[model samples]
Target: MKQDLVVDSDEALNRKMYLVNNALDEIGFTWCHAKLFMLAGFGYSVDSQLDAIQSSVKVVVDRQFGIDFPVATQIFYVGLLVGAAFWGFSADIIGRKLAFNLSLLLAAVFRPYYWWNELVSHLLAFGAGGNIATDVTIFLEFSPAKYTWLTTFMAAFWGVGQTVAVLVAWAFVPSHLCLAGTPCPSSENRGWRYCWYTNSGIVLGLALLRLFWFDMNESPKFLVSNGRDAEAVATLHAIANKHERLCSLTLEELLDCGEVKDAHDFKTNGYTVKSVFSAAVAHVKVLFCSKKIAYLSTLIFLSWTLIGLCYSTFFNFVYIYIQLHGGNTSGSTYITYRNTSISQFVGIFGPVLAAYMVTFKRLGRRGTMAIGAIITMGILFGYTTVRTQLQDAVFASLTYFFINIYFACLCAYTPEVFPAIARATGGALGVLFSRVGGIFTPLIYYYGLKSGSSVPIWVCGAVIGFLGFIALLLPFEPTRFRSV
Candidate 1:
């Protein structure tokens, strides 16, 4: 009887999750889900917002600070690395609601941060970068399993944010920047400040929308794992009430499953920290439950790391190269921002196509990811050989489109591959490694890259191609498989 009970443990817990998913699926897609998608995507949007803002203002920033490279972007990457640690653990400790909004508020309310611009910029970056994973996790919990592809499709917000940032930059930087061989002092160049102010206003508005526009619920699993079975059931019923659907799940049924032992769970010995650590250990053990999952996790983590390094080293600096080093007279700052806006707008479609292609049985998520990565790598290699402005635009646009395709698949795929019990732990660790890899970009810029040299671009392409091969090695493909 004891052995039989042990065998039924995971099965019984999964039964609980199955019921919750059923309740969510029955509610179907509504304005609620749509609103949640857009709102949760704010986190995704802010990430690219900061990236686009910093990259577009690189010239002015470099000039303003008397630096060679834009250190703000580098500092942003460092913030992402450090911020991950705090955000990862805090969500579970303090309720997700405060933690989520607090991060956005911290980022937005920096108008008084004039004492030290660079220091405050990194802090703002920290606030924005930290909420990314939290946003994805929250949305996934509310998502109907059938529409899981929306997770990838939601990446469209990233492009939207980036395009808007570039447009703002274009509006301000063209007539305000210090041109090559032209004197540009802080008094003369107000464009970068305008860009920062505009971005901060936009972010502040998002925080307000998140706070007042939508009322978010605590994740059902979070409640279940904490022995709040009644609340978990009530939360599901509330969503069904809003959507006019009948949920068949009952509080007693959830209680019948015994203690929730699945996702966001801990093995409690009535010891606080030790229990949490044990829960994390159990989560990690489950991630490597088999050779298949083990290999896939390693490949996924490695893929993220390479992507972080390669993308930061290439894309972050590619615009500067196009503006300053390309052949002929098209290297003007105005033309660079204009072309960048176009490229960003075109990249918005990549995630859409990725969402569709991932459902293909022959290709599935793994094939889509592999194909996108390889094509993007090829495009990056082609970018190195472009000699004219038109060629640069075409190559750069294609690279953004395919990189978004690859990236959308990755963001969706990582969450899908990990079991619920270990999903958060594995996903956080993956982002942590990616940011760790990204921090080396500044080091490369400091040590290896030279102005007008395409060596780093070429190396980035080579590493990405290697990552494409690694994408194929991911053994567990969660195409039609529902994440538990």
Candidate 2:
């Protein structure tokens, strides 16, 4: 673990490892671009259901099935809750790239159920949640220290997804919406179906690109943590070779320390149920082993939970709420969809702004995240007070713009705080808690709507603001603590 210990034995090998580290950074910059392509596609796929709703896919489902639309959104979150935890554990055990590819493929396979049963279609939502856990973990692992900030930038593609969905709806849904309270003739209700088909095509293409186009190596940090020093060294050298560079790193150099050998010997035993449980327990211990990490992890869990509540409740039902509250002035369904598009377009700047703000000497990561959260809370409260369609559109747009920034920072910050060995575990747990909140959001939204249209908005605002204050209590600033 100490560079000096290795240097005393063979100065030349130490220098070679240093050069290998540099080469890894160069390769990361190139690989980071490829990962972005995949992340962008994955982002697009993850939001497909929302795109469907904004595009009047909900109208088709509501008209045909006679089911309340909110119930359908809640079912999707049910799948999401299962998938997020399952894939998070899978990525840590099966390896990131394999888990990464499988999540998208699974989602694509489940997408066609849009035709037969509304409940079955949410199976795609389950896969999409899995994709989120894997995509963020994979991107974080591959990014070099100097450019780790790129993780937040990758979230901008999420906005791209939202925009693409809206554009597709604009092109197809305006002319094709089934009239409300009537049987939606399947043959004529082609707009939402077309959107699903296009979304599936994009996901399928992304899966192939990840499998065939990108020759990504296993994470060297992961290998080192797992006591696979030989593979770690080889991976580093392979990265150098792929980038047309040279590295003098050898397996012996990597294994020079006796500590690593002792660790490797301890890990060589065959797998067992007890061992699996022990490993899970050990990861939990590591996450909260220190007071600083305990505070950080606990607050992050709460923040993610609140985010889930806000994201599911607002995003799934905002368009409908606007229609109900301001329908007289909300214009046609097309204009409401257009308003969604315009908001997403404005949201494109959220991550870009966060990318810069996170680097500021004064603001850094936590400061920026705190500021974004506070602003978002204010916007959420303001959103409840809008009287006209124009006011609703403007406030809602600002709410998302700032919330996206907070979300980006949270994604970027979560993995950075954990060590390489437990990064996936920590992230997955956060998603698990978040999804638990998501699982309840629809029920809350349903009952809140019964109570009053503004009830959910007020509750979401108060909770978001309270959670933001809690996050401010996180003991360590990951940017300052790790520099990654």
Best by lDDT: 1
Cα lDDT of all candidates, in order? 0.74, 0.65
**Candidate 2, poorest ten consecutive residues by summed lDDT:** 1-10
Per-residue lDDT tens digits for candidate 1, residues 223-294, read 664566787888888988987887888888887877755444332324377666666676567667667677
- Estimate candidate 2's alpha-carbon lDDT, on a 0 to 1 scale: 0.65
Count clashing residue pairs per candidate. Answer: 0, 0
Model 2 Cα lDDT, one tens digit per residue, 128-235: 776655676666655555666777776777777777777777777778767776667767677776776776776677777777777767766556555677777887
Best by TM-score: 1
Candidates' TM-scores? Answer: 0.90, 0.86
